[model samples]
Target: MRERLFAAAERVLAREGAAGLTNRAVTEEAGLAKGLLYSHFADLDDFVAQLVLDRFEAIAAEVAGLPERAGSGEVRENLTGAALALLGTNGPAVAAAALSRSAVAERVRQAWEGGAPGPGAVEEAMARYVEAEQRLGRMAAEVDGAMLALAITGTVHHLRMHGSALPDDNPELVRRLVAALVTVP
Candidate 1:
């Protein structure tokens, strides 16, 4: 039920933008009762915050495995894969929705700051992977792993939060950026 509502919210955000987001719209889109959302979440703000945080958690969990793949794949593909993971399904719209409401945004910010998984977790996971690859002689010794992680995550964050297209929509674009950021060993 929660996932269904979240997906409905994503569609609303993507098609109607921030201005049109409302509990009623989300419920209607989900084909659930108007008050069904309230029954699940404390309020609209809680729903929005959970949606954004849940998405971030999903991406972070995926990137958490980056270190394990360090020695097996091409560094660019590994790193670019992590970057793309950060931009999960409907990322841009989800980000826009989070930013559209002050209460929701603050709730997410506080939850992230409180150490729940979020954007920083993705960056940290990538950095760990870079360092692991560096130690394995899979990457150049001169490259700063943390900066590389930042570059990839920052660029991905931009695309996730500001881009109109999904990362999957133009993976080559992300690959290009990742290529530029990662050095050949």
Candidate 2:
């Protein structure tokens, strides 16, 4: 039942945006009794909150699963591929929905603290990247890996929000961004 609710929420979020979701929409989409939503969730707010948490968990898993390319020659390729994969999910609606609720924000925060990998996942990836770069003599020894990771993640997130309608799963821009970031100038 929770799975059904989440599936409905995911579809509605992707297709209609946060502003368009309602308990009725979820129930209808799930093809469940209208009361099922209320039973599982205290209210529409609860449903949306859980949905946001679920998304964060999903995104974190995706990031954490990226193959660790430590000690590889294509550091940029690996990092960018991971970053793009994490950011390019259909997320505008999820972001909008999260913006509407403190519960969602709190849940996201907790997940981040737990190293779930949605937001902080990028930072962890960067740390790995910076370590790789240092090992390869690409970045300066004293460079802040976490800060660079945040910057790259922010840039990628913004690009995902505003860039051209490229395929979400394609890693071309990710590869390019990674190349630009780690290349010794």
Candidate 3:
């Protein structure tokens, strides 16, 4: 039920942007009673924050497997895959929703700061993956895994936050960034 609400919210966000996202809109989109949303969430702000954090948690979970992928596929491909996976979700819309409401934004920030799964979690997984790749002699020995992780994840965050910069080519930009950082050899 919660997942349905989240999905409905995403669709609402996609079609109407954050301005059109209301408890009624979400509930109607989900084909459920309008009161159902209030029953599950405190309000629209709570719902929006949870939706954003849910996306972050999902991406973190997906990227968490990066280290396990080390020593397998091309290093560039692996890194690019991890980077693109972050963008593959409806990150920009979710971010826009959070940014549209200050309270929602603050709640999401506090949750992230509290060590709830967020960008930092993805960064850590990336660092571990890079370290694993380095161990396998796929990445440069002198490269700083943590720093590389920061670079990639930071760019991803920026792109998601300001999605209009490269509207049609975020994945390409991520791929290029990963390529510039790590050599295939």
lDDT at 16, model 2: 87
Q: After superposing candidate 3, which stretches have Cα over 4 Å from the reference?
A: none
User: The CA-based lDDT of model 1 is what?
Assistant: 0.87
Q: Please, what are the lDDT tens digits per residue for candidate 1 over residues 1-185? A: 99999999999998898878899999999999999999899999899999998898888888898899978978899888888788776888888889889999999999999998998998899888988988999887888988888888888788877884544555677888988888876
Name the 10 consecutive residues with the lowest summed lDDT in model 3: 159-168
Backbone clash total for model 1 is 0
Score residue 74 of candidate 2 by CA lDDT.
62
Considering only N, C-alpha and C atoms within 3 Å, which residue pairs clash in candidate 1? none
> Which digits, one per residue and each the tens of the lDDT, describe model 3 over residues 1-185?
98999999999988898899998999999999989998988988998999888888888898899999999978888888888778756778878889999999999999999988988888898899889988988887888999999999889888887775656788888888987887755
TM-scores vs. true structure, each candidate: 0.94, 0.75, 0.95
Q: Rank the candidates by lDDT, best first.
A: 1, 3, 2
Candidate 2's C-alpha runs over 4 A off are: 65-67, 110-117, 136-143, 159-175
Please provide, for model 2 over 26-127, each residue's C-alpha lDDT reduced to its tens digit, 9 standing for 90 to 100. Answer: 889999887889998787777776766666566656666443556565666667766765664655566677766777667666766775546666567567
Evaluate model 3: give its lDDT: 0.87
